[model samples]
Target: MHSLFILSVMLSTAVAAPFGLVAKRPLDDRDWTRSKRDGCPAYLTEGQYEFPHYMTQVSKSEPNLAFGPQYNGIFTPNDVSTVFSFDIPESRANDTCTLQFIFPRQEQLKTSSYAYEGTGTFVFTGYNPGNCPGPQTTYNNQPGNGPFPQFPPIHMEPGYAYTIDVGPCSVGAGTCVAGMTSTNDTYFSYFQDKDSCPIGIYTSYS
Candidate 1:
């Protein structure tokens, strides 16, 4: 009886262990560039150059201040945006995953001069070989709304690619800006419950 009880406990522990996947900039080769908005300098283009949207990779391990110059110290309020994409491995097929754009704590933001009061939105879309739809999930972050906002989880299928569009917009009539800290790192993370999968795991942006 004792052996059976021990076995049951072990199984319960395994079931409760959480596991998931993660993809970050620089490390995963998910670089950011400028988006098209025009009116900007020619050699200053990166992602697209139509709307002042820029994308550049940043690392927690090193300094990346030289990437986006014009919009430095501040992510343009509503006028600029960034994009990132990653692939879902076949091992996690048909798994329900919670997607989150991780950022530094509120206290960290408060201490940085680069921080701004605004609402940041993340749009996530899942795509397969020949099937692609509108955004599957959208997460919005507002000033004084805590460090992490509640974003709806998503179900991810194996062999599919995902794209996350992150943009910041002004809050109401006031200009909204996102602050950055020298010691803090920002990236997207995906979580999967252990009960629904074979293993539990946690991943970091670095």
Candidate 2:
């Protein structure tokens, strides 16, 4: 079975989470410049930049099956883990800014009877030799995606955008590989991916 998990994963009551386990900044349209993804800036600056993921990888005993990251729908059920590759322009690398994985809720998968559980502890890590998603990046890539901190799962409701800040480590690292896995495997925890596609996953950095 899926035994690998972060120390923070634990049994908890079900309720809406106003805040996630990891730090998430309020939608502050402060001094940050106009949000856009025209191209890499001369250097890192104080602004929220939008970027799309190049590719995604899923790990499962069976190949060619849709689940986890592979599923046009990112349900993240079972023991499946996923990785997303992003090509951070050398100029975009910086230690001060944070890299965030943004997942917009498309629809609710579970029914009204289904009690939503907070997402179990989510572990985000940096893959070595971070390269843009390619043929080599697969679901079985658990070897080098590690040595990162685990954050408690967050309660997610539809209509709101969820953000997972993977830290600045991948900011300057060219071909940054960001990975995610849930320690909690429950109906309420990962019920976000039920019917429609949630592949609109992207990243935001400032």
Candidate 3:
């Protein structure tokens, strides 16, 4: 009969995929309780907004793709290694997301010379939130903020730990520059301190 209706439409399209809608009733521990717990949304997703568009080169400025040089991932001219990422949602269990890369302190204190800086960090953790209570820990922000001094939590059963920072510009001139990685670590890099003096460092991923 048409090969059994093409194997029942390929098993009904794999049971309406989407990981088959998960949850086959198995969440023990009082059904994984967690009611009304707020205080973990410092900026991620709803974390980028700046406007004033209307110009034709007003002294040329506005090339701050988070840290200038088109975020130097090196492909020509002059590189400064710059890359970032975010997009984590496997169901978002126990919710907790914070992402900020605001590095532009008065344009790195007015260009120290050539302009370049340094910073690096990383952390991520996921899986099993349906039966939580133990095996839970997190950190990556808390310490005047910038260049993580406290790190731990980069294990989501897939991949993590993507840190890179090559530089030589730290004569106490860091107007603004921050780092913290783990959107499940796909890639990361930070190296732009050409003597300092470049603005635009606003990135958030939740």
The candidate that achieves the highest TM-score relative to the unseen native structure: 2
Looking at model 3, report the run of 10 residues with the lowest lDDT sum.
Answer: 1-10
Highest lDDT scorer? 2
Clashes of 2: 5
Q: lDDT scores for all predictions?
A: 0.20, 0.35, 0.20
Tens digits of per-residue lDDT, candidate 2, 48-145, equal: 44333433444565544433333231324454454444445556556323333323232321221223333433444444435334455555544253
* Residue 50 alpha-carbon offset, candidate 1, angstroms: 30
TM, every model: 0.24, 0.50, 0.18
Q: What would the per-residue lDDT of candidate 1 be over residues 75-184, giving only the tens digit for each residue?
A: 23222222222222333333332222322222212222223232322222121111111123111221122122212222222212221122221111021112121111
Worst 10 residues of 2 by lDDT: 5-14
Q: Could you give candidate 3's per-residue lDDT for residues 89-159 as a string of tens digits?
A: 33332233222122322322233222222222223111111211111111211112222132342211111
Q: Which is the better candidate, 2 or 3, if ranked by TM-score?
A: 2
What candidate 1 gets wrong by more than 4 Å, as runs, is 1-74, 106-114, 119-206
Candidate 2 has an lDDT of: 0.35
Error of 3 at 2 (Å): 50
The C-alpha RMSD of each candidate to the native structure, in angstroms, is: 20.5, 10.2, 22.7
